[model samples]
Target: QISEATDAPEAFVAKILQPLSKKGILISNKGKQGGFTVDLDKIEHIKIIEIILATDGEEIFTRCAFGLEKCSSEKPCPFHFTYKPIREGLKSSLSEISIYDMALKTEQGEAFLKI
Candidate 1:
């Protein structure tokens, strides 16, 4: 259902689900009634940062926006300083946003999962 709704291949969704499940962000069942679900009790404590890190890893927070091999403060790339603050800001925002907040936004039509 998620794959179809997102227009992503089942394999792609499966790959994403594996990491999330391993990280305890998702609960997966493997039977006729099998499906993945989030623990509603814990959902309010699950920040966007946790979901992103579980699925995408730390590279998104560490890698260069311009794809420079060794971009860093010591030997900065062209956009290093400029991108640093933006990345940090995004990280901070994600850390503060819970899945519940996003769900509320989606439910209230203030945000969306697609488009």
Candidate 2:
């Protein structure tokens, strides 16, 4: 839908779609009435973290706070130590959740609706 609507390159669209499909995060249909739709039931089982990591990568939050190479605990960058906790927290939160939790919360009106 995104690709068709946006007129994006097929390769680019495929790149974006493949990972989601492999993770069962997206379902695509074929034929005259074929299209794409989110499997809400399965989606409920996914975590925000998995989606983030799937699309972005686990290192996204921890990649050298200042974009420096070889930043680490022993030879940390000036900002590394300070950024560590924040990065870890973000990563941990993402890795510890599922989409189901989000759906249930949303259904119960316990989750915030984003525009």
Candidate 3:
């Protein structure tokens, strides 16, 4: 249902399912008729950060935009001030939202993972 709803290939969706299963975001079953399922409790608690970490890694949050040798507050990049707040907002949003919230929207037809 998730793959279909997202309009993604089953293989691609299966790959994504790997990290979620590893991080305990979801549990999957096997065999002729088995599939993935989530513990509602875990779904509600698993933040987007956990998903991103399980799949995409956290380098995005830690890296300097310009890739400068020294790009900290003491010797900031040109975009540091401008990018900092946006980054912080992204971080906050990722941490604040849980899979349950997204699932709810999808379930209600308020949003779709794919057009």
**Top model number, lDDT:** 1
Assess the local accuracy of residue 104 in candidate 1 as a C-alpha lDDT between 0 and 100.
93
Cα RMSDs, all models: 1.5, 4.5, 1.9
Residue pairs with backbone atoms closer than 3 Å in model 3 (clashes): none
Question: Residues 1-115, candidate 1, lDDT per residue (tens digit)?
Answer: 8898678888888888888889899999999988789999999999999989998888888899889888899999989999999999999999999999998998899987677
Query: Order the candidates by TM-score, highest first — what do you get?
Result: 1, 3, 2
Candidate 3 total steric clashes:
0
Cα RMSD for candidate 2? 4.5
- Per-residue lDDT over 1-115 for candidate 3, one digit per residue giving the tens place of the 0 to 100 score: 8777778888998899888887778798899987788887677888988888888897677668887767877779999888778777888899999988988988899977887
Q: After superposition, how far is residue 82 of candidate 2 from its true place, in Å?
A: 1.3
Error of 3 at 81 (Å): 1.8
Write down the lDDT that model 2 would get: 0.75
Against the true structure, whose TM-score is highest? 1
TM-score for all predictions? 0.89, 0.66, 0.84
Write the candidate numbers in order of decreasing lDDT: 1, 3, 2
Model 2's TM-score against the true structure: 0.66
Candidate 2's displacement at residue 44, Å, is: 3.8
